[model samples]
Target: MKTKRIILSALRSLGKNKLRSFLMMIGIIIGIIALTLIVSVGFGAKKQVMERVNKFGAESIMIRAGGGVQISQMSANQGTTTLKLADAEFLENIIPEIKGVAPFSSKGNTDIKYFEKSATVGLLGCTPSYAPVWDWNVTAGEFITDEDMKLLNRVCLIGTTVQKELFGDSYPIGEQIRIDNIQFEVKGILEPKGTSPGGGDMDNRVMIPLSTFMRRVANIDYLSAVKVLLHNPKEINTTAEKINQILRERHSLAEGEPDDFTLITPTEATEMAEKVSGTFNLFLALLAGLSLITGGFVIANIMTISVNERKKEIGLRKAVGASSKKIVLQFLFEALAITISGGVIGIVLGGAGAVILGIVMQIPVSVSWASILTGVISASIIGIVAGIQPAKKAARLNPIEALK
Candidate 1:
């Protein structure tokens, strides 16, 4: 009953000083907002990283032609001739860990036309191993066969986007289309994969046999990149290092000289992407920390003023036999009540902020109990830390002196 009175008295005091109560809670509200952003951003970043790693293939590695250049930094035309089909052949034969290798080249925005409809799309040159190496298969017809590679047949596989653009609701199988002035027959329809690691539409490309692409289309002997799959993903890094060493020896570069190729593993790509997002999250964490600290100070200052203003009230209550512990409890309760209320409001506003952020950045953001709990805990900690000194001050007051 005594504790209940203290709480009621605390609520009455807050009700009488509405503006001062709001002033104390403002800092907590802002701090909770920052904390909410941290949790939501964390959720979004993790999901995106997983999706990117899955798309890149966890059990595979890519050997891009350009040396010393990061996969994300390499341009379309930076193809180096040092990494050849021979290097791929050697890697296949020498590396026991490697399951398969698919050497391919690519060009973007190549025009493809059917009867009257036309669409420009990204083009890829792929071998038969491209299917199993990537675990990507056709939805309707067959992938590039060994016969297509041997004969350099002008045959192609169209992605769902291309199929929709050209064939529409009609069947795409056996449809003949012109890929940049060369007539190619569509042999298959690719599964509708959503987007690439680079954020391009994965369903917006055409796949042709590597031989045909190199000879009939572009007349290039060098491959743009090679995708390698592993029988055991646990050996990916070791295999990558082994392939790197052999390629260095085969290319005949000096002991210290860099090899004319870059090997990108799924783990490395995931780490790279996380580094970018992690740095951003770190910055937000700092801001949240700073805001909470500022909130604590704001709360403490207001609580001190509240203590001073209620000195006479405290003295009267003490004279009426209220204990010092009761005074402390009342002050603490007031601080906690305001903070809890502010935390709730901040969470709602922050969740809306996260949704807006997701729309603007084109990333997925989720609000869960984790976000709510984070906001509540953050606000509560600030409230307690800020309430302590003022609560102590109120408890230690000399009733007679305070009454004066």
Candidate 2:
């Protein structure tokens, strides 16, 4: 009952000086907001990174040709022996762990024209299964079918940027676009994928059937890369080993000779993204921590001044038979109450700030309970510790001298 009375008295004293209490809470409020916003940004970045990694599909692998010795090394060899479409076909025929393979070649930064409207874009030649293998969604018309591949049809699917440049929001289906003087009909428009987290522009590419590209465009029997889709992602290492063995045998390469191709997994891409995000999160957390430390110092300063101001009151209570321990409890409880209130307000503001940033900045923001609890508990501890020095000073004051 006595402790309860002291707490109530402390709260009443704080209420009497409302503006001062509000001023004291300002530091804490700012600290909470900063911490919350930074942590939420970290989580948002992680989400974006993970989403990009998954865009390549969990079961996907890419095989690309590695550059060989220079032309000067051998007069007859210009370093052109590389992974071919036939190699991909052979793997498809033999490898049981491989679900499917799509051979693709691409060239970028070329001007394409459609009825006088022209734009510089990337052009890629790929098999029919490439679309589903990469998880690309078609917004209109249809993707290249087996019939298109068999006939070597000059049909293409355009990215969002190309569609806007050539067709300008109107339906681009049935339109024809000329790439490097070769005409192709627009069969579909890929759903807007925007820019990737790596800053690559996926929305500016034009995709065409591999057969058309081989016949009319590059005229090369070799392929730039092969996308290998696995049946199971967890068995990637084993699958890669088997693929290397097959490729070495097929190429007739001797021992200690490096394979002419590179095999990359989606898991490696995801790990790269995670490492980048982790560093960003650490930087943000450190920046926010500094602000929180400054806030804690401000809280300590205010509590100290508060102890000085309430010295006469403390003396009066002690003269009226209040114990030193009771005096300490009262001041400590008052500081705690003020801090708890500030902490609550800070959390609400911080969460609101995160949501507002997500909407306005066009970035995703997420707040977990762990972050909230950390902020609240840290602020409360700051208040309790900051108030101690002042509380002890107030408790040890000479009552007679305090009254004078």
Candidate 3:
């Protein structure tokens, strides 16, 4: 009954000064909207990044040679040569837990041409095992087979972007293309993979058999890295340890010698990305939260002025048997009602803005239940906290003096 009367009084007061009430909640509206948009964008980015990583087989680990170690053999008289095909084969034999191993080498800049179109693409050299390790989907034709690798076939599978650049509407399969002046047939086209958030152009690569790459392009029997597929992501640490032991022994490294290779898991990459995203979101949230705090102060100030203006009414009510508690409740309810209404409007407007931005920007937008609830609850709390002191002051006023 008291709650109903207080709410009714709050409604009447707000109705009497609609402009003033709206002005008081401006800060809160801005705060909620900004916070909602920031959170939605942050979570959307995280989800997209994880999806990309998952496509690469999250359980897989990449083992790459340390800096400046390109080849497998180094002589005292000659220069450095870091990774060899034999090393990869040896690791496979020694590490029983590894499901598969695909040693890869790459040429960063390769002029590729098909018909009248041309593009400079990253030429990846790997065995057929790479198809499984990388979880690549060949949309048309077929992936490189073990037999093709054994025979060192001069054939290539192009990324979707590469196909678009080189073939246009023409069927790429069996079409002849030139890579570094060497002729090769188009064996496959990879499924379209959207641009990575980290700016990796996954759709602009070309893959070829490792043997063909060594003989024709790089003219070297070495690899830059070895991708290993594990039976499960849970065995990441164990598999990493085993690979390290095998590589150390194979490289004939003595105790205390620095490792010449590094192993990285998808989880590590995901965690790093998440940390970056969290920091960015936190900075934005803080800025938005500051606006909310400022809005609370506005509400407090307005309520204070309201109490002064209504002093005569308050005095009359008190003289007519209104308790101090009832007066306090009335003012607090008014503040809360204004803030809660503002919160609702802010959420709806923010969501609409996010949807429009997502369409325009070509990015995902998400609104979680927790975020909506948090906004509503936080706004109400802000109103209550801001109004408390002023409400108490009004409640404690001397009715006789206030009537003056």
Quick one: best lDDT, which candidate?
1
* RMSD versus native structure for model 2: 5.4
Task: Return the candidate ranking by TM-score, descending.
Answer: 1, 3, 2
**Model 2 misplaced regions, further than 4 Å:** 1-8, 15-26, 65-81, 137-139, 192-197, 244-262, 319-326, 337-363, 367-371, 396-404
Minimum summed lDDT over a 10-residue window in model 2 is located at 69-78
Task: Please report how far candidate 1 places residue 351 from its true position, in Å.
Answer: 0.9
lDDT of each: 0.88, 0.79, 0.82
Better of 1 and 2 by TM-score: 1
- lDDT string for model 2 (74-181, tens) is 111213546778899999899899988988877767679988799988788888888767778589999988898899999999999888888887898998889888
Residue 151 of model 2 has an lDDT of 95
Over the stretch 242-356, how does candidate 3's per-residue lDDT look in tens digits? 8888888878888989877766677776776788888988999999899999999999998899899989988888998889999899888988988998898888888888889
- Which pairs clash inside model 2? none
* lDDT ranking from best candidate downward: 1, 3, 2
For candidate 3, give the lDDT: 0.82
lDDT for 277 (candidate 1): 84
TM-score for each candidate, following the candidate numbering: 0.95, 0.81, 0.89
TM-score of 3: 0.89
